[model samples]
Target: MAEVILFYFLMAFILIAALIAVETTDLLSAVICVGAIGFGCALFFLFLRAPDIAITQIVVEVLALVILIRVTISRNATFVTGDREFFASVVSVVILMMIFLMAVQVLNSLPAFGDAVFAEVTDSASKTYISQGMEKTGAANIVSAVILDFRAYDTLGEATVLFTSVIGAAVILRKRPRKLPEEPQI
Candidate 1:
């Protein structure tokens, strides 16, 4: 019951933040609202018992927010003209509301927090991991065994992608040295 309440509260907070982000004219304010929405999503991941996902969400959100804020700070303000902007905002809001409704319905169909789910499958990979992970991998921790031994390539791929993305963002955001014009020859 408490979890459900918290989830609803977070959902409301995220929705409000999204609305503010879309409606605000100020770029900084809009960025801040978007950050709020990202953090709210991180909280949702935490509630879903996915700490790894929550941590990743937080890191990505912070990086994205920093990049967005920096871009907004470096760029000149441009006045938005015409009804097209308003129409686009309306369309975005409608889509967001539809997604929210669908998510709520899906959440309603899921089991409550801490509920036990009994799987009838006897020859599952998880079962094998639980039974023989430590013996095969020689790691004391099951998670370490699975990640380091069984899923090492997958983890390496994820790390490579993250590193590449960070480097790309850095390259894109870095300020280039201004070129000085040569003096006219005598």
Candidate 2:
């Protein structure tokens, strides 16, 4: 009971922070919102008893914060942006509201949720896993079993792309044509 209440509270906090993330004029404040939103969401997931997802969310949030801070610190105009029109902002809010309402409706329609869901989803997955898990992967880690067994190639490809992007970014960022004389430090 208390957890459900906390979940709603955290969900509200996440939505507010995410909205502020998009609306804030200051880059630093916006970045703060992005991290706050991510942490709030991770808490919400934990409240729902999904610790693994919560951990992933927290790790990704930290990575994003580090990257954003590095980029913003290197530029004075990181937060500068052309002003959005009044009509455009209004339209954006309306569309967001419609999407929220639809999501709420869909969520409300789901009969299986909360504690009752765990036993059911797990039972079903376990059955499938027992039947075909070896085909998915020969190993015994249920989580990794599901991921690697079921989606090994997909995971491998994603890792390859991530590695490629990191190497490419490092190469680009490290390139320098020539060295310049140091000026007086202000």
Candidate 3:
């Protein structure tokens, strides 16, 4: 009951932050609101008992916030509200409502909380990881065994992707060197 209440409160907080991010004219304020939304999502993942996902979310959110804040601080803030802005806002709200409805429907179809749906499946990968992970990988922690030993290649690929993305963002955000004019010979 407390978990459910916390979940809804977090959801509301995330929704308000998202709306503030979209509606704010100040670039820095918008970026801060977006960071709030990301952190709220991390909290939601934690509430769901996914500590790994929550940690990843926090790392990604921090990186994103740093980049966004840097860009927002470096750039000149501008707002251009016109007649179409109202129309666009309405359309965006309608689309978001549709997506929310679809997500709710999907959530409704899922099994109840704390239900062990995978228990019946004897040959599932989760079962294998939970049962023989320590013996096979010689790791004390099951998560470490699965990530470092069982799915090492997959983890490596994910790390490579994250590293590449960070490099790409740095390259894109970096300031270009000013070109020097050549002197003409007499």
| Global lDDT of each candidate | 0.85, 0.81, 0.87
Arrange candidates, best lDDT first. Answer: 3, 1, 2
lDDT of 3 at 33: 97
Least accurate stretch of 10 residues (summed lDDT) in model 2? 111-120
Q: Residues 71-176, candidate 3, lDDT per residue (tens digit)?
A: 7785665452444678897998899999999999998877786677788677999999998998898997788788899999999999999899889977876899
Where does candidate 3 stray beyond 4 Å? 78-103, 120-122, 170-186
Of candidate 1, the 10-residue stretch with the lowest lDDT total is 112-121
Superior candidate under TM-score, 1 versus 3: 3
Those runs of model 1 whose alpha carbons end farther than 4 Å from true positions after fitting are 78-146, 166-186
TM-score of each: 0.62, 0.71, 0.74
Candidate 2 to native Cα RMSD, angstroms: 7.8
Residue-wise C-alpha lDDT for candidate 1, range 33-131, written one tens digit per residue: 999999999999999876877998999999899988887885777333334678897998899999999999998887765663433466778778878
Listing every candidate in turn, what is its Cα RMSD in Å to the true structure after a full C-alpha superposition? 5.8, 7.8, 4.4
Error of 2 at 61 (Å): 2.1
TM-score of 1: 0.62
Query: In model 3, which residue pairs have backbone atoms overlapping below 3 Å?
Result: none
lDDT of the structure predicted as candidate 1: 0.85
Between candidates 1 and 2, which one is better according to lDDT? 1
